[model samples]
Target: MNKTVWIVLALVAVLVIGAFSGYNSLVNMDEAINGKWSQVENQLQRRADLIPNLNATVSGYAQHEQAAIKAVADARAKLAGSQGVAAKAEANNELGGALSRLLVIAENYPNLKADQNFRQLADELAGTENRIAVARKDYNDAVQIYNSKIRTFPSNIYAGMLGFGAKEYFKAAEGAQQVPQVKF
Candidate 1:
């Protein structure tokens, strides 16, 4: 009887240790997701900040293109006020479309394309877009890992109990798959 009790105690201790390890790992993964998302937001904010300067430079030569300029500003405002991944993604797509139109307008003005300030701002915007892409990829990757963990084996049991639900991915908006046409 005593031997049986000792064996039972050992099993209980092992189970306890395993539970702690699993919980800690989940916490670490959840934190990693948060960090990656913050990076995505940072990149997004950087792009937003660059927009005003870009718009100003474009405006100097394309003063008549008020519709395109207003669209970009409106999209930027929508992005700023947006909450959640889905909403932000939608707003981002709107902003991207508006910016593309704005650029197309710029193309009509040869002097605008040749302007040094416009060139610099455009380059910076392109770089920031790249950074935003990388950051979104990283965030989605982390979410994928975290979601996998919460859906798998023993961890799944406690994950729900601990309130660690699956995280949402930063998905691109619809129509993103289509190639944009640029006609001269």
Candidate 2:
């Protein structure tokens, strides 16, 4: 009777330890996912911040292309006010499309492309876009890890009990696959 009681206590201890470990792991992964997402948001904000300067510089040279300029401003505002990963991703994609059109329009104005200020701002925006891409990849990777953890066997049981749910992936916005028309 004593040996059986000891065995049962040991089993319970192992189960408790396993549950605690799983819970802690999930917490850590979730935190990592949040951190990665913040990096993505930071890069996106940087891009948004650069837009006004670019808009101003281009406006000075391409005064007639107000439509393209307005599109960028609208997209930037939408991105800034957007909430949640999916919404933000959609907004960011729209911003990306708008910016692409703006750049394409810039090609028509030789003076805008030749201006040093425009070049610098465009380079900065390009770098920020690259950073945003990297950050999004990191965020998605973290989400994958976190989702896998919560969906696995023993951890899945603990995760469900602890209320840990899978996170949504950052996906390209609708119409992103279509090439944007740049009509002059």
Candidate 3:
């Protein structure tokens, strides 16, 4: 066989192996990221479920805190209703802010704060928030892995050919951790 023919055959073999490995790795990584995203959604949903109970408990003592309750509800709805990762993350950050304000409102009602039901609900919500933080971290980790695989050299070539794109991180919006200046 000619030298040119041997060289071409060797190049083709390497490409075939590289393409297969890259494509498979991308698929697995994408699936892991998607799974992590689902966990994040579930954690957020759990927090949303806790809102109505928390609001009702607080409302019994602070009836006039209407606008604040509505704000929490609205933010939860937005978080649930959003369609994409960026939209959901933005909404989640807003919801966190709104709920923080509601907690601050709770501080004004000493009797309510001392109630067992209210205390339990608050504890559950706090636990949910912790879970959300952990879940978001996991989701972001998966996103980093997937995005890296989808962008790196040989994998990037395979990713483009296979229609894989960079997965988004569920990032906190501005002031996500700040105490909201509650007008209520």
Worst 10-residue lDDT window for candidate 1 reads 171-180
Put down candidate 3 lDDT per residue, 19-123, tens digits, no spaces.
Answer: 888888888888888899999999999999999999899889999999999999999899889989999989998999899999999999999999999999999
In order, the Cα lDDT scores of the candidates are 0.92, 0.92, 0.91
Q: Write the per-residue lDDT of candidate 2 for residues 1-184, one digit (tens) a residue.
A: 6999999999999999988888888989999999999999999999999999999999999899999999999999999999999999989989999999999999999888989999999999989988998999999999998998888898888798789988999997677688979899
**What is candidate 1's lDDT per residue for 65-124, written digit by digit as tens?**
988999999999999999988888889989988998998899899999999999999999
lDDT for model 1 comes to: 0.92
Best by TM-score: 1
**Order of quality (lDDT):** 2, 1, 3
Better of 1 and 3 by TM-score: 1
Those runs of model 1 whose alpha carbons end farther than 4 Å from true positions after fitting are 179-184
Candidate 3 global TM-score: 0.91
Q: Candidate 2 lDDT (Cα, whole model)?
A: 0.92
Candidate 2, clashing residue pairs? none
Clash counts per candidate, in order, are: 0, 0, 0
Candidate 2: segments with Cα more than 4 A from true spot: 174-184
TM-score of each: 0.95, 0.94, 0.91
